[model samples]
Target: MRRLLVGLIVAVLTVTGLLALRAELMTVEVEQPEGSYTEVLVAADVVRENADVRAEMTHGLVSTCRLLVNADVVEQSFRAVGDGVFAFRLRPGLDEFDRRELRGCLSDLRVQHLRVHVRHLQTVTPADDDRRRDGTPAAGRR
Candidate 1:
């Protein structure tokens, strides 16, 4: 009985050690706040698709942009602009701050070949009483 208990403890310790070795986790702090926002248009390119390059780049950029901008994806299209060229329209929760963060993030993006590159960043100001795709008034003033 004592041997069985010792074996169980060893197994538990092994599992715990493996868990500790896993990827680091992001530390969550205060919730992302929302404020007046402008639409941000971003462009990138996928020079190649061999070895799932397109899919990998799309997922990676979307993830990083989300982290930096705290924006909702208004729209995204792969190869919509041209072959291997991608476009994304993000509506950030915060106005100027998110815009700066997104621009900064895109500027910081870099890789050697077949890498996602932020070719453009544009801030689109909506007219008063702007409507969404569903034709309803956007979050701010109506």
Candidate 2:
């Protein structure tokens, strides 16, 4: 009976290992795009203060820049409305880094309207045909 139990345990362990391997193999790997997403460090300059704040951002790709805050995995992309003004679509995962960056802007102008300027840009290329075949914008491509 002891021998039978040991054999069963070994068999279960082996099956589990095989299942893990299979799972790992099933995962799809995505390569970083050539210019899909670019990381840009921005400094917000506040120009006015009120119920709604207004600020301007200075960056190369002001129209398609997202801010990753605190390394928390949450990113907010700003849409350029006009002149240095941008619209931020609020999303989850706001990290300490984002808060710190915003704070820096507020301190500079004492308001939420921050003028952002990108200091660093990380550009990636677009995804492959398979991703676009299904009409998917590729991971983080949009």
Candidate 3:
């Protein structure tokens, strides 16, 4: 009876291992696109209470750029939207792999140690969208 139980356990473990291997091999791998494939622009503003913290935040963004090799990740891509206010963007849509890579890289960037207040976050229309003069997206646009 003990031998039979052991054989059953071994058989179950072997089957589980084989299934895991097959699933891993079957996953579709997408190569990073040479050009824009997806895009999600985020508008944000960094809190301006102290210059020292602000500089530190800017410095930290360089690490974000380095960790993720994409040149389009936002850094100084901000513009004046109002008095004492500015707008920034966080470009997305690289792919699931890039996002996952960025998430992992952010952990190493030590963002938890930084203090920057980003408020009034909103998603802007994608650049790929061509809008008409009336503020509606152009026809037959992706």
Which candidate number maximizes lDDT? 1
Candidate 1 C-alpha lDDT tens digits along 15-115 = 98877654223223323334333433344554544644655565566667667656666654323465555566555444544555555555454432335
Off by over 4 Å in 1: 1-52, 75-79, 109-114, 128-142
Q: Least accurate stretch of 10 residues (summed lDDT) in model 1?
A: 23-32
Clashing pairs in 3: none
Per TM-score, what order, best first?
Answer: 1, 3, 2
Q: Each prediction's TM-score against the native?
A: 0.44, 0.23, 0.37
Candidate 3 global TM-score: 0.37
Clashing pairs in 1: none
Q: Candidate 2 on 1-142: residue-level lDDT in tens?
A: 9999999999999999999877644423344433333333344454554413333333322332323221221244655455444444323322333433433442343323554554333332345345767787644322
Can you give the lDDT of residue 115 in candidate 3? 38
Clashes of each: 0, 16, 0
Q: Mind sharing the TM-score for model 2? A: 0.23
Error of 2 at 83 (Å): 9.5
- List the candidate 2 regions with Cα displacement exceeding 4 Å: 1-36, 39-79, 82-125, 128-134
Candidate 3 has its poorest 10 consecutive residues by lDDT at 36-45
